[model samples]
Target: MDIPVRAHIERLLDAHASDGLSEAVEQAFRAVPRHLFIPPVALACRDDGPQIIDRDADPDAWWDAVYSRASIVTQLDDGATDIRAGSGDYTCSSSAPSTVADLLQRLELAPGHRVLEIGTGTGWTAALLSHLVGAANVTSVEVDPVLGAQAASNLAASGHAPYLVVGDGALGCPERAPYDRVHVTCGIRRVPYAWIEQSRPGAVIVLPYCPGFGTDHALRLVVTPDGMAYGRFPGFASYMTMRAQRPQRDQPARTDADKHHLTTRVDPRTIGHAPAGADLAIAALTGLDSLGQADQDEDGPRYRLWVSDPAVPRSWAVAVWRPGQDEYQIYQVGDRPVWEEVVAAYFRWVGWGEPGRDRFGMTVHADGQEVWLDTPDQVIGSEARSAC
Candidate 1:
């Protein structure tokens, strides 16, 4: 690990080595050179470590960005617009090293395993997978023609030749069916039948599933012998939605109610119940398929979340961030009164814990995102339908 490339991956591998995924991740990291994957962009290495990048700043900031924890939005709307101008609705990216590590941990890939990666952004993940199980054992798909070609070059430069395809990922590549594992780099509102169909019996499929709401939760499922996959939320993570699957949500409705008030605009009838704290609010909203954040705003940190859903709106619960700063209030309203749903869902999630996101399983049918939780084999709407 002497060269810039070696050092970049060495640091990444070190972070996860203690976590049992060290070997698979190390092989993958050692196999691919991240600098080669990020084309034309000036290479910047940070002394603090972890090759995360912030592509928004000048040359001086690029080094810090690449090593930081935040994801550098690679393609906005699948390379449709300028991210610098704030319209690059994220499509693909070189995800932060830790996130990639977490996803790989969820994947649980073993030696000699075959894996299919949905997005080849920077070809980093695919290269890592290829390294873990040999390049011949990996197949990667990218929707954008340009990105696909670039990834091919990136993979080639990294000394691995993963079969890269320029096509839709939602329709997983059939030629490479019966894969031992399937992992998606992009966020998906709908889980594709292709994944379940192509996965070999007992194969594990890990992906971020956005059930047509404001927040997308990571789903790590295993293909059962019967062609069905059941798993639970590994954790909360978000990605730029796949190009064809971006939510077509209307702007959130604005209520005349005061931002710092108890009165909600939605009918009280909709309020089955609410909880006593922000944690419960966050959990319930997330249980409603909405992800919520509950934290004390200490030190006045600025946090921004990107969203496009009317149902799973976004808001802030502001509080003092200093010593003896205990007063807290909800400032929810505007186009998206996100916190409203948080309070609304807290009551529901407080109860859903009876079973849990894990207890809720997926039974793929020919036409539905069929899922039921301790309940029966109830059919559910596709991610798109749920948004509507």
Candidate 2:
């Protein structure tokens, strides 16, 4: 409509032209006005800090932000706190234009194709999908009823009415069975078997797989003849975790005298900020998730690599790195040998030729999923905890 946010978005879509962003997909992007989907009062996430924009207070700023590359924060604390009040886990939002463009391109939608969408946040993506394929062919599911109703109104005002269901998206909309394509907006820890069961063979499912480890990835999976779906990581993605699969809050650290103490030459940053492939490898092998936190000490900068099991919250390990130190201290507080297993996994990833995210593949079936290297049979790990 309004001239499109042509430069940056076009360049991003064009770069992925070979594998994604077909002409129809680009037109669909131009067709959906992002501002219509965004709330009047929302937060625009920035690297420095989140700036709150209110349409009534400053319509100019709100319009600019909706068109900008920043993702708009629509809800905070799952709607527990007012967005203007500030400070809460980002529960929901309209994804950045770049992310929406990348994922829609990967969907490869065709006119008249049946599509099932999960997490109908703001309904912008469903509208886009409806534009690509007829609106009657699209079905969207949202977990939150309030957001679902709001999204319904937004879609109606925009002259698109895709089927909207209020239910847990992980379960999927089974009534609209045998979908031609599946598009997911939320980050998933487990690939729900229901999704595969509902889709026909050869369905293309695109989702953000956030394992709570290092960097999350965008996966493009194709359902197979035998009812299994296999795919590879196309690139990195960082979306909020699916509400159903969100991890428990970490318990306070134990200060027991029997704690294991060790020192290693490996910098904590090496493991903390490892490439996406290594993150997948280590999480799969050790059954542990990791995150790095930065701190300032008297000597300048320090890093802490936190490794913990999502299933067993009590078991954890922390590797601390200080400036100018060849040796870093590692503290293990549980029986999992969390540090040792992580070190082994780290070296194992290195031994496998230091594969990047592109070389990793995932297989999802009814029971669970597995992450493999290069091919399906060469499964590096069989845990479904990080597969979705």
Candidate 3:
């Protein structure tokens, strides 16, 4: 049953080989049985998004989902929610085949090289790494104990055995230090210095950088001899945040109701429509999390932007814009001028030629991480320089 589906996936991946997919990764996909790693009733990958696939309820749909180029959500709300009940928050998933292939290709793995993988959600990636670098050279760490044990079982069933550690993935597995490559399967707001410290100089570290404003991007950093990791974001990616670094979803406290109102000629949509790099720039500059929503008003369409510090609840800002309006209304509270900083970031991004994620890179030093555009000398904002 798995043979034909595996072949079809391999063919699809091979078609994309010219676009960065490598033959080695294609072979790894062909050899591994992804279904073995997922739950009996799990959400299968689909073009539109994830759809539930219950082997007992619908076998054919389940098979198709296992073979589809989509990510299978294995756990919801960190395993607290009942997926069988219909809806839940996505916590862990078997990443889409194409995404996994892309990350592996970017890794540029070689035989006999030691690799450390963080966030072994379902163990499919670990199996692929084992196939590429031999099981003895692969070490995978998972933050969830249940997921770790399940991954171990799945790997054993697939006849591949890799070192599996059940602990926080943010702190890379030091038991196996000096790894040649480190691949993280989760999104992180801040890249842990421990990952750089654990890797050998020149080792490559790939992870999804999600600063919580726009979409996440796959950041590829190479460990430097001077105990720093620096690299550029190649493309956009979406992954679950590490357990420890997950954003607090709580709404900001409504303590300060004395909101200062002001008017700005800058349209909110301009910043909203800006490239993902602009969001990264805003996050770096303001050091604040932003959320945007759209709705219909009596006048027509309306958009609202919320910028606040999740850690420090005192400072928050809101900007409201309506279509055909030249001056947008802004309400700011606390010491920080959140909306003003966002405007500054937008102009700064445009001043630097409005570069894409590829043109932007990050340097993670002992002092702090600094986001740079085109070159490391040009830091994103004055705040980053002072923080570093």
Candidate 4:
């Protein structure tokens, strides 16, 4: 084992003992050089974690990005649009060690399992799988040409050549069907028909179900001969949604300047178990009281959340747009009191037992897109609609 890398793996194993994920960590360490898998010369080792070896920030000081315990983001916004500076909504990353460990533990890949990894961000995960199941049985798909080329080079240099393809992962590479294990590195709003059709019966597929949960969570599913599997979210995770599969959250504001409304901040304390804290708020409002969808407005890079609750006479905003921008406006008529109603969710959670974020359960139906929260009974679904 690589001495320096092994030390880091040992620490990680010690940190997260539940998963017993050291084997996978060691595999990542020994099989691939920490340097090559990231942007050339943009990585730095840090005591707490991996430091950003951002290439665009300083071209002259480009350093290898592969650092101990660091997950380098190879593609952001699925590499569709450039943010110029500051990483925005990390879309594709060489997933961090802790996250990788969690997924591996949940996935539990055995030897000789043919694995197809969708949304190969940096090819490191595939390389680790190569160490376990051998390169011939591993197939990885990457959407970005730039990242894919870099990943190909990294894999080639690492001496593990899996079938790496640069194309839309939404359509799982059908050329190699009947994979025993299908791992999706990217977050997806929709579980594509192509993936189910291609996998073998009883195949274990792991992917981040995106957009549904306020945050993405890993969905560990089983494949039947007919391409159907029932699985709940393994845990909360954040991954870049697949480029082709990114959900269209184009919720246009309610352009009723003449209209008025009532709104409130879903108490942060009540961020109990539900796909995401935000989703939990939405679920409670829709179920308990009469409410429709929520709306957030972006003004020159800042987002202002706008909500309307017919139950209340007044409205307010608790700020869900962007965390940093200084634009938190909380308002409610003394009588309407939206904040009080919002806090009512917290009390409800307390009454039920304060379940943390993980306890929240989700069941993806046969369609794969529709999700029910807090068991199938708490049905909270998302659809493409104008921001309202």
Best-performing candidate as measured by TM-score: 2
Tens-digit per-residue lDDT, 130-208, candidate 2: 9999999999999999999999999999899999999999989888898999999999888898899899999999999
Kindly report which residue pairs in candidate 3 clash with one another: none
Ten contiguous residues with the weakest lDDT in model 2: 1-10
lDDT of each: 0.60, 0.86, 0.83, 0.59
Prediction 3 global C-alpha lDDT:
0.83
Question: lDDT tens string, model 4, 110-143?
Answer: 7788888887677778888888777899999887
Candidate 1 vs candidate 2, TM-score winner: 2
- Clash number for model 4? 15
Q: State the lDDT of candidate 3 residue by residue for 297-345, as single tens digits.
A: 7888899887777666667778888877889998888777777888887
| lDDT score for residue 85 of model 2 | 84
CA lDDT, candidate 2, residue 5: 49
TM-score versus the correct structure, for each prediction: 0.70, 0.92, 0.90, 0.69
Better of 1 and 4 by TM-score: 1
Summed backbone clashes in each candidate are: 14, 0, 0, 15
Span of 10 residues, lowest total lDDT, candidate 1: 267-276
